[model samples]
Target: MSTRITGTSHLKSENVNVWFGERHVLKDVNITFPANQVTALIGPSGCGKSTFLRTLNRMHELIPGAGFAGKILLDGTDIYDPQMDPVNVRLNIGMVFQKPNPFPTMSIKDNVLSGLRLSGRKTDDASGLLESSLRRASIWNEVKDRLGDAALSLSGGQQQRLCIARALAMNPEVLLMDEPCSALDPGSTRRIEETIVELSESMTIVIVTHNMQQAQRVADETAFFLAEDGNPGGVVEFGNTEDVFNRPVDGRTNDYVNGHFG
Candidate 1:
């Protein structure tokens, strides 16, 4: 039987498991991302951190042989319900990748609106959304005059923010990010971290990060994932960020937060 989650959760995973062909990647991963808060997933590479992130909005199914069991609920509704459309799921829950992935051929303005246009969503105020989204992503001042410039023309950090702006243009209720600052310089990383904190005021955010400091700085709550001795990945411990980092209940979590081992 599926467990019922209590409290004011914006997004939640209940007994979620994921597989790629014959290999199980995620095992019974359960998490509740509270509304307007940032929840970070931290773990070593190959521990299914990214895999679990993709499962949030059914993005995992895009891969060949990728499958998952259990429910991913958004506001008490199972997004994986047969009656729900995947396109709408994605539209409501936007995602930004690890690397900056702006459309190489599209202009800055066009890139931000690309989601809406491709989704056949007509915005009465495209110009207003373009500015507001860029502003929210913290890149409006940098690229305001250059809205006509190619998205790739911006720096690595700028590109990532542009990608963020693109996601924001959809007005999603929740945002999923996969190590968005991993590729940028420290300065850019700091800026992105600040943006993450700011965005949390308006929407639920779930992020995967290898950087413990980043998680501590931005996440209100944190979950640590681990896959040891040929086992599928699962949450070792989860709680308020301070507790997860400073007073982790699991020894493994303690080691991870203290940099003893990944």
Candidate 2:
């Protein structure tokens, strides 16, 4: 059974498997993301944490020979259904990459509205959406006065927040982040973590992070992934954040979380 918020699931993966050509990277992974909450995916490198995050939004298929099996459900509908358009799926499930990727030539304000414009979706109030998105990202005060400046003019942390604002302008139902804070300094990471917690009040968030302290700080739930002895990665344990870190049922989970071994 999956967790439910207000009588419905937010997003979930059922027996999901992934392949890069013939190499199986992930196997039979199942996890549910409750609505209005933050879930963290934590694992060491080469454990398929990023791959699973990409799968959530159908971004995995972008690789030339990548393939996926099983269901990725959002609001009880499988996003991979043959009839579903991948573009629309992405629009509903926004993604932020490991590094901040704002368009270097675009202005800060333009970056925020780029998603809306590219999707051919018109908004009655572009300025309003821009301000709202930036505010939700906790960056409006910092960049509001420099909206016309080039996006690259901002610092690395600011660029990440701007990228987040760009995704927010689309008003996605679920947000997927892959190591969103790995490249930032401590102060910037703190601000981004704050933003993550605040965003969870309105929309579901699933983040992939290697920072154990970060996962415990912002996630309501955590799922630990591992691949041992040259095997494919899969969920070793999943549960509330505190439990997963402090009282995991699987000894492997305990070992990984306790710094015994990854």
lDDT of 1 by residue, 31-67 (tens): 9888999999999889998999998978899999998
Give the per-residue lDDT digits (tens) of candidate 2, residues 1-262.
1222132337999999999999899999999999989999999899998999999999899998998999998888888989788888888889998999999879999999999778878899999999999999999999999999999999999999999999999888899999999999999999999999999998899999999999999999999999887788999999999999989999989889999876
Task: Please give the CA lDDT of all the candidate structures.
Answer: 0.92, 0.92
The CA root-mean-square deviation of candidate 2, after full C-alpha superposition on the true structure, stands at 3.8
Give candidate 1's error at residue 102 in angstroms: 0.3
Give the residue spans of candidate 1 off by over 4 A: 1-9
Candidate 2: which stretches are off by over 4 Å? 1-9
TM-score list, all predictions = 0.96, 0.96
